[model samples]
Target: MNNKDMKIHLTVDVWAAQKADARAVRFDVFVIEQKIPVELEWDDMDEHCLHAVAYDAAGHAIGTGRLLPDGHIGRMAVRAAGRGKGVGAAILKALMAQARQRGDAEVVLNAQTQAEAFYGRYGFSRDGEEYYEAGIAHICMRHVFS
Candidate 1:
């Protein structure tokens, strides 16, 4: 269905980094769909990060993202069914809110080349030349809070 015709109900929650729902959504989008290595998917940093998960009306996790203590945002993923439904934006917003609440002056993220424009819309600007991570093209992006 087209976006306008679809019923879009998204609930975003911020929690400790290892929350199951957040991990599940990231697994589906990153490891499963994008083929990122399992070893790279689960990292030591998770325990110290702030996580955001987006759930649909059916209570299924649809998207996830994380904000690191050093103001780095990463691991953003949105399930295929949730694409174009604003689920990713919801997840990012939740992460950014948490960052602001923590008194961060800015947040940085490595945006997949194809999704750079998506982050750009949120006021993130490219900070470096394109590079590869997990064998996929990416570029560093940063958003400064005013």
Candidate 2:
């Protein structure tokens, strides 16, 4: 389907997993689908971070991401069915908005090698050498804005 045919909803909440259906989407895409260890998939910092999810017109969560007070954006996930539909981009944009609302000057993320170009589209620039995280090659990226 075309992006214009898709509807994206974005929100930030303290209960990161209150949207069980949405968190399931993250689990499927990040853990089970990508073979990432469940233990590494989550961190204690979630309790303090702002979580955002993108829902489709029918209300099923299609994408998800989070923003930490220090300007870190993490746990971005898009369901397989939502891939290529601009869901990821919408979620990232929401996270950046949250950062700006909190007066952050920049947002940072460790993007998977395959997704570097995707983040680049949102103005994130590669900042360091590649490294391994959760058994996947990743690069540090940052988006600076006024």
**Residue 64 accuracy (lDDT) in model 2:** 84
Model 1 TM-score, all chains together: 0.89
Which one is best on TM-score?
Answer: 2
Give the alpha-carbon lDDT of every model. Answer: 0.83, 0.84
Task: List runs of model 1 lying over 4 Å from the truth.
Answer: 1-18
lDDT tens digits, residue span 1-146, model 2: 37443676666787546457556877999888999988887777777888888888788888888888799998899887778888888788878988998899999999999999999999999998999988899999999995
Off by over 4 Å in 2: 1-5, 16-19
lDDT of 1 by residue, 7-87 (tens): 445444445534888888888888889999989889888887777776677777777888888999999988888888787
